[model samples]
Target chain A: MNPTSLAPSELAYVPFVSVDNMMKNVSAIGVETVMKGIADYIEEDFLRWESFDKKPRIPAHAPQGVIELMPTSDGKTFGFKYVNGHPDNIKDGRQTVTGFGVLSDLSTGYPLLFTEMTILTALRTAANSALAAKYLAPKSSKTMAIIGNGAQSDFQCLAFKTMLGITEIRAYDIDPDASVRLARNLATSGLNVTICKTAEDAIEGAQIITTVTADKKCATILTDNMVGPGVHINAVGGDCPGKTELHKDILLRSDIFVEFPDQTHIEGEFQQLPRDHPVTELWQVYAGQAAGRTSEHQITLFDSVGFAIEDFSALRYVRDMLPKTGYFEKLDLLADPDDPRDLFGMVLRAEAGRNGEAA
Target chain B: MNPTSLAPSELAYVPFVSVDNMMKNVSAIGVETVMKGIADYIEEDFLRWESFDKKPRIPAHAPQGVIELMPTSDGKTFGFKYVNGHPDNIKDGRQTVTGFGVLSDLSTGYPLLFTEMTILTALRTAANSALAAKYLAPKSSKTMAIIGNGAQSDFQCLAFKTMLGITEIRAYDIDPDASVRLARNLATSGLNVTICKTAEDAIEGAQIITTVTADKKCATILTDNMVGPGVHINAVGGDCPGKTELHKDILLRSDIFVEFPDQTHIEGEFQQLPRDHPVTELWQVYAGQAAGRTSEHQITLFDSVGFAIEDFSALRYVRDMLPKTGYFEKLDLLADPDDPRDLFGMVLRAEAGRNGEAA
Candidate 1:
């Protein structure tokens, strides 16, 4: 079927990026390059954060997990991500996180792009971590510690290497096989990788500490003694309510930075702190309206809960690259009749056409 | 590609109903039959409305139109519809209202179905109107006066005819062509269709009056002097802020029934009345908890703003029928890998395989 043969009204097509196509797109553009591109978009969006209409994600909490819709708009375009977090899914051979996103024109309320966001989410989460580290981490930092070397650890390593010029990664996981898997994945990459036995050993001489454990609980992966002066903490795993990765004493000793303070306080490690605690908005820091690292000795922490704006940025980046990559399929996701008011007639004509064809 | 060949982890296919398929489905089942089926589902849901979580839709109002997310859950399953209402879109040959919905498993947060709801919304909206009219309209009513003959007119005419045995329809539109188009569509449907020049002519000797205008304003399609006793008013079009079809005096004189009182108070004809005004919950009437049309002289009005539960029921009906009808396509909307944690490795392996194939 030639899509161009159809009338404009009948050609309501949305570009969709499936998992296979997403992998193809990632391979087409090297993973590190894609990570850097996502970081650039994240930084660009963060620099103009006030232009976005930000709100706390709308979550439907169930017995086993939660489904959330995170939406943000920049007056011209609208984007939303439908993501689910079910830690128990892994036991059933499913990923703990699965996501898809839609980018739409605000004027028409029509979706322009629909894409699988599992890969994109991992890429953007790591990009966000490295973007924050660029502003908050100790300058010229070389070695970094990844406490939970799961699905996100490899992305974090590559993002930091590409975006922040970090060359060495010391990775540790509760499951030793996961650390081994992480190291194996980075074998071909130029960055040096070390598989550590314990979290203390992982963070021994590292200037950046990334904790990305998956348990949906308040477990302390980092303590006040583990985190030293001038070290940057990229807290990625303790996102939902009742989940924290760092001790309260460490949060009190560091200068906290967050995407949106209102959301971070509920979902990030900041959830452990008081609601009135001082935390600079990451956008403010990126825009130079607030300080990121005031002194070399001041410890800076990015309490990353992941926000809607980051998803919006990732979607925008993917949409901009679709034309060049052609790694997308058009989906017939909208109903458009020749006469907008003749919706019933459209159905009736289809019936008549089918009857004719069958006869 | 045989979907079953993939591991269960990679067999994440979601059934999608596109516009063409939706029209075919409508044709295969017959429009009125589908409307009746949806009405049955709506009645079943309404009878147990308390078991469902009901919240006002979350709306983002822009200068051109409004986008809304309406979500509801009945403990076991969750459903939400993404809908947009832009009245001016008709001028640009686009739909005034376009919608799509997602139904997901609450336990795992995996989407079970995604379907185009522009046509479904029209079907369900008309079904909801007719369902309410069954309880509120005068018994053995034979004719309905439809004041607006836009996209929703033909469905309303057919729904009342199918559900309430109303074989005659007096349809009038501000644009004469719209009324003519509606009449032409219903020519072979076995109903006596009349194209009226004015609203007064349309309602002449009619027992039921339905106003479904599309203007996003508080324009009175029916005034105090126009409606008489025992006339059941199915107000269909006015469903947003600053939009209503009936005058305040008409509402004051009528016994009002609504889907959800909180939403109807703001978006329905009751928006003209004070907050303290008494209104019967339609679900209560359906459940035998409240009265509906107690007197022959009483003016009965169904003030509907379209609730989320109705959309949920429609989606449920479609999902139940997909297996029997085979009227959907499987979409690869989720990312699944052999080892869910080794997402990056999966992409890397795909790259290597592609390179090997090329060589």
Candidate 2:
């Protein structure tokens, strides 16, 4: 009656992309090309936003930090990312945010892919910002002012260069060493980079501004006077409750855009305004149902507090690239028996195999 | 400027228990003994139930089945289980239910362990049922009738033998092959086994009755006339909305005990009852705040819907066993840089290493 008379089968294996292989894949295919590919997928998904099953992320909050699960399904494919935000982890040599994600088949509910998402998240976030800028930023924009240089700074700068053709970067951080590290990492990326002394100095003549500070509290990284007309603002750091980077006055002046209004109202810059504050859903603009940039001198804000659809697109991109790169390992993560009803029989076979018997 | 100048570090690696290693661990510690150990952890966690965070599982439903995420935390440690229920998966040589889980440190929000929970879920679910029986079942029981002899049948039978000293098993299933398979799997175990042609014959002399039928729709495998007095019924398979095994008349007469009332009302036998129907919480009984078995004439029913806390306890038990068994593999699942803020720098170093240059 033992259907699986011997050992484990191929059905038990799942594909896993580790950090080393993810980096290898990035190098195998150029990083800029990878980011552009992710950006295209994000835009494609956004164009059909009504097809998805969406919900706000589930979060477990602690005094020190929070861990969250962001899940979404598009009828055929389902994806989720497990992520954490711990601002105090920097002193102990840990990332402020780290993540991993899974994509599964909706029909069978079997996981098709598991990958390290810390690096992928940076790429997708940058790509999402650049994608928004393409719709809202001025046509001749060539320079970007990056305030609060951190781990995501280099990716954002490179993604802009790849997706929007930006050629110059003016970077600043409260700590000078962060700016130095960003410049050092981007040394050979073919963009003119300048280290600025203050936030005002960074945004002096740039057409686009990006604020990505890692503080857990409310801090004004950009004020009303700092944001000029016709300039696009990518606010990425204020993503949780009690976290905001732009002053309320700046928000009042800029026409805001967001991923999902329900979530943005609680975590994005919209949190500073009333619940009825008018904000555009990014998917609407991508779908051509809403106007993106109506005038030459309008202030456009992409209040970017990352979303699950972007992660889904990132996972989709990685899964598509696996065949070309061959950069994944098979993990024996599921138990499969020949006769599914005989799971206990399979275990007994394992014990027999352990005892050197060929039953 | 590179924090992880050479290669990956200890922090980048997370311990993973594959299906093969899980089988080896089960064999290393005897299955009966392992079930008993898991039962202890389940009871221990139940005693401090109020200290843990709880939530109804987040589910994504498809026409074929459903995928769910069950998450919980106890302030210090966090755990989540990813599971799916596709009753039709058996036709395609897959288990009806498959799962995997992760345990993490809440302070740093770093994953400590990732393990295959398909087999572990079976162990935990069986342990959970047996633990409930220890409280609700009549003290002088020696035989159990398991109505549906499918994947979870053997584990449930062995768990009772290990946890409650049950010495006889009378099993029945619609598909007679399933009962034969269960008998073959438990042949070496010391308990006497019998295959019954009818559900009525199976429960003729049994003190405890377990109904674990697998059907997505509602079906009454047991009726009011089938149930007798002083019988403790373990309703194991009626665990999702619109899926139940027992008749409503049986539930009306028995004093029902449940894991979590909110979840049980939606998924357990309580779904047949009113929303505000009275049911005793099993945790309260374990905590000595409520009663278990009161009189010889009273019929007790443990409406087992399964909860996130049991998965947490299962993960905790597996993590503790890993050190002694040494049956796990290390996976490079996290991106750890020497300088936590130098995530981009670490990727650049990987590029350098790939190009045969010293980082």
Summarize candidate 1's per-residue lDDT along B153-173 as a digit string, tens digits: 999999999999998899999
Which candidate's TM-score is highest? 2
The reply for model 2, stretches above 4 Å from the true place, is A1-7, A357-359, B1-5, B357-359
What is candidate 2's TM-score against the reference? 0.98
Tell me the tens digit of each residue's lDDT in model 2 across B242-334.
Answer: 999999999999999999999999999999999788999999999889999999878999999889999999999999999999999999998
Question: Native contacts recovered by candidate 2, as a share?
Answer: 0.77
lDDT, model 1: 0.89
User: For residues A1-359, what per-residue lDDT tens digits would candidate 1 score against the true structure?
Assistant: 23332333534788999887888899999899998898899999988888898878988878899888898888878888999999998888788899989888778788889898999999999999999999999999999999998888889999999888888999999999999999999998888899998899999889899999999999999988888898999999999999999999999999999989889889999999889999999888888899999898898999999999999999999999889899999888777777889988877776776666667
Candidate 2, residue B38: the lDDT equals 92
- The candidates score, on chain A by TM-score, as follows 0.97, 0.97
Cα-based RMSD of candidate 2: 1.9
